[model samples]
Target chain A: MSKYTLREAMAIHASRQIRNEDKVIVGTGMPLVAAIIAKNCHAKDAVMLMEAGPFDSNPLALPSCVADPRGFVGAPWVADPVQMMGMILQQGRIDLGFLGGAQVDKYGNLNSTCLGTYKNANVRLPGSGGASDIGAMAKRNLIIIAHEARRLVEKVDYLTTPGWMLHPYENGKRVKDRLVHRKELGLWGGPEAVVTTMGIMKFEEETKVMYVSEYYADLGVTLEMIKENTGFAIDTSKADQVIPPTEDELYILRNVADPENIFI
Target chain B: MVSESKNSTKKTKIKTLQEAISQIPDGATILFGGWTVTRKPMAAVFEIIRQGKKDLHLVSNPGGPESDLLIGAGLVGISETNFIGHEVLGIPYCFRRAFEKGGLEKTGYLHDDWTVQTGALRILAGAMGIPFIPTKSLKGTEIIDPEHDLLADLRGKSKKLPNKKVEFIQDPFWDEGELLLIPAIKPDYCIIHVPMVGEEGTVRIHGGLFMDFYGALAAKKTIVTTEQITSEDYLKKQPDLNSIPAEFISDIVEVPYGGHPTAVQGMYDLDFEFFNRMVDSTKKEDTYVQWLQEWIKDLPDHDAYLEKLGVKKIFSLRADPGLGYNPRLKRKS
Candidate 1:
């Protein structure tokens, strides 16, 4: 019922979370959309690091698997994709990481590397580019996926990234001990929030459990709809606001992000 | 030298696009001037392919299928470019397959480095009569020396050849006794396609003049093929709109709608059917030759070439008819 497309809504919601001067690591696809939206809406100083080693510079619109000009055409500075991954992302210089997921679980783990299973799958997808580095080193991560039961699953076919997992340790002490690690370190780690067409959801920082926060305005869909689709619990009180893109936000999106087409 | 005089003094009537390409020699360094899908010199490129000029060193911005045609013909000995992937436009599968198969040789630079870093800066350097411009593009990157051996070799034996300091060291205090300045790329010839040109060779481009003037000014010779030819008075009417003045030009050939099979703005839209045909072909040398012969060689002249395109179809597709055909100029009427 929102005026924005599912992709546009996802971008609008993700854009709200980014601070004005945050250094974000952006990948291709939905990540590029979110970064462009953030830059146009609020994050003016958002530096876009492309895989082709250009910072915030737009190249001629050309089709490329990894180094598309759209990724950095409107960015402030461009850097080498490899150097960005190694020196910037891995070094934890990036504040927030925006990514897309093919499959997501209750724990917020995302699977984009494979389909069906790691070794054998019904289909194959483009394997991870810089997602691993961003997921590992970024202090905070936001994931965007279209709301559907098929995408929101109990378990992913393959574990492309380890979100939150149990850690074992041996020690001699009377006091109890619980050692926890974020997913990037090979231990189980999950995302902070997941934005979808139907509603928004966030994982409990302590429990690493996902709960629905808000529904899209007048989305005839209910908490039960999200619960049934996600196979998870719904948190209604946390759903304070579901913001739509403003006129200025929409203008920037149309002009800067998708000039030739209004699809996004 | 004799051929040069003959080409310069006497106006050689080249009947077809293929005839014009036979003039170029082997191993000639060429600078291609145009942005993506616009203002590209398709006629000259086609001619070069038809003549089968071998061991050519081509310099240009990233391109689509046309780049493949040269690589497919085994004419490109060396290519210095920013990017080579297929954009929304079809990929040059031959170029990709050739590179993957280790058949074609190339030296790659970052897209920004090729476009803004080396191209624009090199042009300014040439215009100012400077030797080179210092850039910070490839510093501390994998494209440095051993990783890009071909690029290093292109720099040659001059110790200052692959100067890294010129691009990096921002402060004089940080001088590590070294600097890397990208040498100006002075090509042997430059080729371009334009919307209009006067009999005196003044050129006008419509939108996005991406590094065309830079390539032309840096190169030794400049050749232009235009969609239409107008008079000097008409050209002088829009002096501010002119992209390159006739004084800088070395040769001017009036080949109206010469950008067939490739899109020429205002005159003709892209001949997608022809482009697709080229894409689907088996990509053998003989197949390409046969393909060119079928489309180009059989035509008698420019008028017949236009006739083959079908006047009805050209007019129907013409968003603006006035944009095409200036009879007074003796281009296509």
Candidate 2:
């Protein structure tokens, strides 16, 4: 069995969460890596779809973004992106969406939108593509971001995609009503999980608050570190039972990712 | 469709990119051709942003904040691009804030095989005079169902009612339908920026055409912006260099060095400092407008805009133009 690098292990851990029955929509970057790992390991039947309309296809390499045709080079099928947006996403075909964010808040809301305050502040990030739709429409959403205090903040400066608890209406309401009425949507019931380089986090089903669910093995980060970063109490039970990548998982990752030593 | 004669009589005139863009109406869907910052029509794009045309839908390859000028300006209401947010360079603040405020409308597409397959096949469909193309693509996936509505609009009269029961197709041997069909897309207008064009509107692109030429051909209308304009004789001299002939061109505006701030292949490297400033400026609509007014509005025309670049800077740019610059013979020392 090949040895896995820390990045691979982290990726695998995130990947294992996807269920075979789930329809997965993934964006670029580490999220793509994690989804691939999930497909190669636990979620074989998971329908892999990209925002660009490639389904269950293995790209030659991870695309820089969703539009780079390189991502769908090895896919089983490809479709027009405009069709994907106008028809598929609007119709609500995607089940689970996996995205990466620059910042995530206590409620699991994300801010990939900007670095500073809204309206005349600092750095501007890429605005939402379909993320707003995914955040609003997808049955389930998962976000993967690197673990850092700066990233896991109390409140995101910008809400690129507002999550569930932040919804305006309670229980079942029209999507538009819930989006429009809410003065501020907190991460009440939005993201199912947030995978990080340091550990995995999930919202408490009852409280709709973020809590640490898992931690990587052989890593020096502590539960307190997670708490310090997140500013919330974490469930140790889930964190301790975190699954480690198997030997076979390591083999696939090393062969697939094969990061250069210098870059690593 | 508008008749060709109506467009044929339209005079081809010299204008800066901004002035050319000012002519476009509101709610116009524009197809921006370029791969990221490589060959974008920056001047036209900047002018569009400055004009603050609302409900603009842009179709192009996603290139982060460098490409977010429209989004930042609150001009973009819809996009059929692949990605946004700066992955490497830095995100544009205006776009980010607008997103956070839920003020922008956006649609993302996948890149890679899907983008190429769809774009290529759709263009082929248009070129072939077909309404749609059938491919094995998206077969067996959730995208196959009309309920998934990957192509069929499920809202208003165009709404596709979901028939959830998967039906079996009866054949001589097999009794089941095997695949799903994805519809083709023909854009309303395609905007292209090239290295050079002749007076007759013959375009010459230096690098791989990618899907730009196909998109232009497939679109109903084609608008071209170029970095340099030469005589019609020069175009005839190099017939092989022309990617799209004058017949294909619907409207041509000679905008010399049109792609400013954004990189133009064989012309200039991306003005990162300007991009960063734009990113910072995008945070507020007023500021963004002010920035646009300062850079784009004040420039009277393309010639004046080029003059703003200054001869010394242009000479420096000419000396080491990245991809397509050809050195002219030096005078005897």
Candidate 3:
């Protein structure tokens, strides 16, 4: 790859998270771009779903929002929110879910509620639509966020999505010497990986603590730059330079995925 | 789902937009049916603001202009929603300013937030005529924390307000950790905008029925505004295509282009430029005030509002017959 925007890099890495046959639920913005790229470029059999109740939607053009009528163009059928949120998602069938929030912690917990207080909010944000539902119900979730010191906080202002917050349980007993885990609280799957504008971060196997896993060196986003900008201490010992997007990935991504230059 | 209109001799009522909205008094808890620029009853919303109903409670699902515009108008006292923002247009500036500039304590505005699935389950419970619904969502998150319950003050104060925020219980049957028992919410009215409605109250929603059907079924009364009103025989021929029975609807308003700025499928595309303009106006308090007055307050009715939008813009937004959305519409992204 000669050069790519930060968003394109994020999209490429985020697209890699999807498997061929994964039943994916994607929120709007870059995640939608990422899902489209994955469907066309890699995850051919993946089903693209959204909160506005479209299941297995295959759109020809980019929808302005998840519930935009355009997304229903090539779908099997349109559904109500009850069928989507209750029958499908709450039933725990979706495999891979994507979410984005205003702020996130090392535990992958997000806060999309408000900046200050709930009642007397300093800045009221759009609250967790399906971020919590997808986080708790989906088998695995991928979080995409902008990397900044204030946003990459030690603890989010409000916990909208349950992340690795408690220890895992063995036969209904909490395991000792372990960081927070979602399984202990009955959440289906927690954050698997966090793809940021800077790089990709993943949680440790045992501790569930987030650590830098990849970085974009060509964009001058080094491991040190990421660490310095982080609000909390982050591990970068096992970090590696990210493999640039392939020619095929780039072509499909630009032409098919986001022809409008929406996210990228 | 049981309803008062069930097996009743009374036919479903039909009224003008103003008259339908006029029946709803101040302080009524309402659920506006729409999500992210789709199927919002813009005509009813405008009328409510124009009528200046005060201290209203709102139930929302990933709200777009329906929720944000109401909050901007400063009519809503409490808004329970998972999300409130114009998706492509940007942040809900009015909603932000309402809370950020005017704190809940100071401004008398409370925001009770819910996760999307949990919100749906709550509404579903209402539609089912159940008091509460069980859910695995909001388990380990602060959404269910008692301290974050913004409506604590309103708890037990009014019939509409539930006594408790949420009751966490372990699965007694299978013993699968804690399950959140979310309270049911049957709003005073559910205003749903759709493409077609039968004379006897058969609703045919052309697009994604984002909680609108459940909302219609659950509410004490439902007002369905439509782009066109068809005959009962026309809808009954394809009963599967219709959304709900005649008993569920309280009234019908034949408001063409009622879901403007956020129209419906097979009828019109969302007015993205209008959303963009509204979002832009919200940046400044004065501009927002001016914009609201110009578009909502100053306008005599939905017809006038449509007139101000101009015939050219209206025709431009009409969805292509084959496609459910306007193909020629140029998007920002």
Candidate 4:
């Protein structure tokens, strides 16, 4: 049996989605680790961008934060928030983006703003810094968050960032009472996939509703276990056991990317 | 020396923290430059807290400790911008407490949120001396929903804020597509911390410019705090390095380690221990008060603040000459 933690598995699995030479915007935490590991492994040409201004940062080691001075070390060009956000991201130059939030709905709608209401909240989270823009503009995005019934809700408390949203899925038709698609809002894309502790979930191409695409059977995470942890009704027909983290990927994660276990 | 002689007639804007911050009136809209952890003007923020400046409207693209300190001290009444938490540090404890707890009740706090790109575009519009900017961001999201406009009643009533959060309309030129016309932000004061500033008020930023350049240009006036102060002649020797002109600055304060706990790229790295201390100290209302007393109230000046942290702790965070960050520093726990 291969030995690996769940977080390492999640990060390694998430890194596989990134393709070579794609420009990606990443924040802190697992997203950061995933991007670094992707660059250190197969996607060597993947460009990493940060809101704090590094366009393409290839760091010596995993920098502590996005604004870690290592971000500036190997960057080709540094930009302000306006240039990075407006000139690049909003203009749709970014290929992929990463987001994490307090709540992620079945449609991948994220709420990083607040819990109860805008005026008052049960739990007040950090409002959208760039999650909305990234969600709205990135051609494809990945969501990294802990898995729990409460977190994977049927409906988010606040729609801080847009995802593939639909209240009902009847007769394979998407448009009904009130329907909103990324294309309808002039947005290019929604979440491509959500990588969780259980496995990975991908949205249906037509309906844009999330489905369990893969599960970590080795970690004792079955379709029933994944479904039990989900708050919304989901389709498990397409679910399959995920590819386990390879020794090479795990080595790159431990030695090349995050040697100190900062993010892992 | 022709450039120096011609600029000599211009006023020198150097001032103490008190001198610069005291001039700021209550209830003025303010913007602090920096994204998350880099180049935050903590010195001015401390002085603002010490002076008990209240009713200020704080705006930043992605705020960190500078914004949190003000919010924690109950200084800001209205916060409009993209965010207010450290990117890696999870979230700002005080910003979280201010909303969940009754901390902001006294200030009648109001918060209106926007996305990152749109928010930065608003500031860019301000810098461009425009009234509004149109973008395709936040179209179907709740951000443009009329019901969520917290600044609804205060729209057009305030001098600084816009009449609405964002005006959604069909693209006038195309007339078929839709876009959002977000308002510009013109703050009364723009506070920034940079590594270098000339005695004659020429600003030079070595690393990422971040949002400081736009923030300075958009505000009515700017207060710059620097780690090193050089002569105009020295900085002018390398002209391409300079960003804002001398005329743009209203005041410049020389504070060597102005952005401690956070970071100022070329000079130092993030003091994670200190950051965790700030986060942990602000976990509870009582602990936060004690933290205020220990860090801000007890210390009268920047030197005292640095002394409290000690030279060892400060020096340990110094950036490696080549890497621009301390290579030996331990971040992972």
Please, what are the lDDT tens digits per residue for candidate 4 over residues B219-314?
A: 999999999888888989989989878778889999988988777877898888888878888787789889998999888977899889998999
lDDT of 3 by residue, B1-333 (tens): 666653378655778998999999899989988886788888899899899998899987767787877887789888888888887678888788777756565677888888788788888889999999888777767777666677887798968888887887779999887877889988999998999998778899876888988898889999999999988878989899888887799999999999998868999988878878888888877898899899988989999999999999999999987879997887773
Worst lDDT 10-window in candidate 3 chain B: B3-12
**C-alpha RMSD over true interface residues, each candidate:** 14.6, 12.7, 3.8, 4.8
lDDT of 2 by residue, A1-264 (tens): 455555666677777778887777777666676676677777777877766556665654444444443454556655444445445654567678787777887777777545665433355455454554465446678888878888888767656566544433222222323332112332112478888877888877666667778777556667777767664445555676466678877665656542322011
Model 1 regions more than 4 Å off? A2-264, B1-20, B104-116, B151-180, B261-268, B271-277, B280-293, B296-305, B320-333
Most accurate candidate by DockQ: 3
Over B137-179, each residue of candidate 2 has an lDDT whose tens digit, in order, gives 2222111223322223322343121222122222334433332
- Could you report the DockQ of all the candidates, in the order they appear? 0.05, 0.06, 0.57, 0.52
> Could you tell me the TM-score of candidate 1?
0.55
Off by over 4 Å in 2: A1-6, A167-190, A235-238, A258-264, B1-221, B224-249, B252-333
lDDT of 1 by residue, A79-145 (tens): 5333455356545666777777687777666665445533233443333334544555566777888
What's the true lDDT of residue B92 in model 1?
A: 56
A1-264 in candidate 3: lDDT tens per residue? 557888888999999999999999999888888999899887999999998978888888888779888788888877777778777887888998899988889888888887776666677888888888888888898999988888888888777887888443343333445555577677778789999889999999987788999988868898889988899999999999998888888888889888877666
lDDT of 2: 0.57
Off by over 4 Å in 4: A166-177, B1-7, B101-107
The C-alpha TM-scores of every prediction are 0.55, 0.54, 0.95, 0.95
lDDT of 1 by residue, B82-142 (tens): 4342333454555544453333224231111132234445555554567776543332222
